[model samples]
Target: MLSMREFWNIVSISLCVQAQISQQLSDTGHTWNYDDGENDWSKNYPFCGGTHQSPIDIYSNIKYDAALTPIQVVGYDSPGIDHFTLSNDGHSVKVSLPATMYISSLKHKYTAVQLHLHWGDQKRPQGSEHTFNDRRFAAELHILHYNSDKYVDSQTATAKEDGLAVLGILLEVGSFNPTFENIQKYLSQVAYKDQEVQIPAFSIRNLLPVTLNEYYRYNGSLTTPPCYPSVLWTVFRQPVKISQEQLFSLETALFSSNVGDSIPQPMVNNFRQKQERAKRELLASFKEDFTFPIAIAFILGIFVIVAIIIYIIRKRRARQQSESRKRVMYAAAQKAEGTSSIEI
Candidate 1:
């Protein structure tokens, strides 16, 4: 006994409810390479367009503030045979860390949560998210921590400014690095998306540089979507060396898609481009030595000038020696022919 208009209205309302439920169910269906398109990211996650985004290029001319204290990594060398979970989350390989690890340089203590990496492909060797003076390294590591003093948990801290403190270490290709071997050995186990494996405990302190004194600090956001601007970024001045073979393993060992996906895509170049450092000041722990680059350039210039002068002198001496030999040969022929006396 219902009219056609009323029947259609009821059907529409039911469909809307179903759609909302379906969306909520599949909210975790996001991927790094495919779904999170660079151009389309802002469409899905409006926060991708936030002002204070991360992975910025650290220029040479940075403000040196002596007040910025060196970060004290407490409990990093805790003695234990702890087991950690290493997983490939379709974007990059992430290893979960224990809550006991914390840093104590800033105003509030920040507890460790997890660590991850970002790397480039074989063709483009430089893949670090943050670059120094526009120079990129082979890879980069991010150790994520949350403010334990102000927030109850990491989840609550992630939305507020001064919530997260991320320590970034740049990786250069060189001799074998034992510090990274702990995680590198288990990469094959988590080669596919959603795959996880247990890794034996190792000292997290060894992964960082020997000295945490030199670093660049800034206020920025997360590099990924839902780009919350709550991270206090601390990038080290020195780079850690890792072998090329280890880099190859990191680049080729993971797949962006799950095992059952139609196409298997390798998870490489999972780094966000350098974002604008809008209205932000980059503070460095050490003073800028303005003469270092200039001194290097001056030494190289002197070496080049000396090399050119030596080459010119060598060429002139060789030419003179050849002429002298020709003159001696002419004199010997004249003496043998008895024509030297007639010419004199």
Candidate 2:
């Protein structure tokens, strides 16, 4: 029983909110899961595939080069105010319009618009992607970053071929992650549909396992619908352990709305269908020239900082030497003057 103006106002607001969904523009090419009779859940989602889905099973015996030494990855304390903005619904976190992103493997200089997670039953028989000596974690973290150059338009951008990179971190249950606890602490504030808690310092660095040297690499598509085939998949070989109890906490917290009062579904094996090799090379830690690319970047960033420090030290030393020389010359001049006076 509302007037036309009132209805239009509400509609306008919804559209405005929807307009902020994607923060980046990407190619139009998309991928989807070929319908399988397994789960009614993934029916129409673009990324779910029977033969080319994500969360592939990774065997350790695959040939690879020696593992690379661990390198430090710096993260921005704050991604941006708009990027992590919370939505009205408490269930989903939304990244504001225009998914800005940076890819370290492609050179650390993109901005991630947003990210989401995918999980499954209490235990998966097939195992998760990039397994740890054949071990599988309960769930995984997919952090979606868009190419800044490609994500120039917020309104019309899809995570297409021109711009997308996803960081996949495997989650095993063991001791509780303080970070997860922090996110959980804020869950009650927005745990319904699409609400989000803007978390600063939520860097990929902190989310990663202690060791980044050992991992699996491949080219894959986003596991979700509108399955963009532009992901540079980097699945860590190491599975970060989380206790069964801890795993349940995340499952319950993240998907409270998706499941119908299931007492926080146990996330035992929520991985995607394995995709075909598709002539793709699965790179393991002990396989590629791991150290060179990282070493070079590390050296470059360190060189700039170190060079400044060295220059400061050299200047200070030169100043001290100059003062010492001046003092010695003054003393000699005074001594000669005294000797001349004595002679006179």
TM-score: which candidate is best?
1
Instruction: Report the lDDT tens digits of candidate 1 across residue range 109-161.
Output: 99999999999998987889999888999999999999999999997777666
Candidate 1: lDDT over CA atoms?
0.85
TM-score of 1: 0.78
Global lDDT of each candidate: 0.85, 0.53
For each predicted model, how many residue pairs clash, with residues at least 3 apart or on different chains? 0, 43
In model 1, which regions exceed 4 Å deviation?
1-36, 79-81, 297-344
Best candidate, lDDT-wise? 1
lDDT of 2 by residue, 129-230 (tens): 444544555766666666556556422334344355566787766787775554445655555554455644354445667777776766676664434455
Model 2 misplaced stretches (Cα beyond 4 Å):
1-52, 60-72, 76-83, 86-101, 121-134, 151-159, 198-204, 254-271, 287-344
lDDT (C-alpha) at residue 318 in model 1: 92
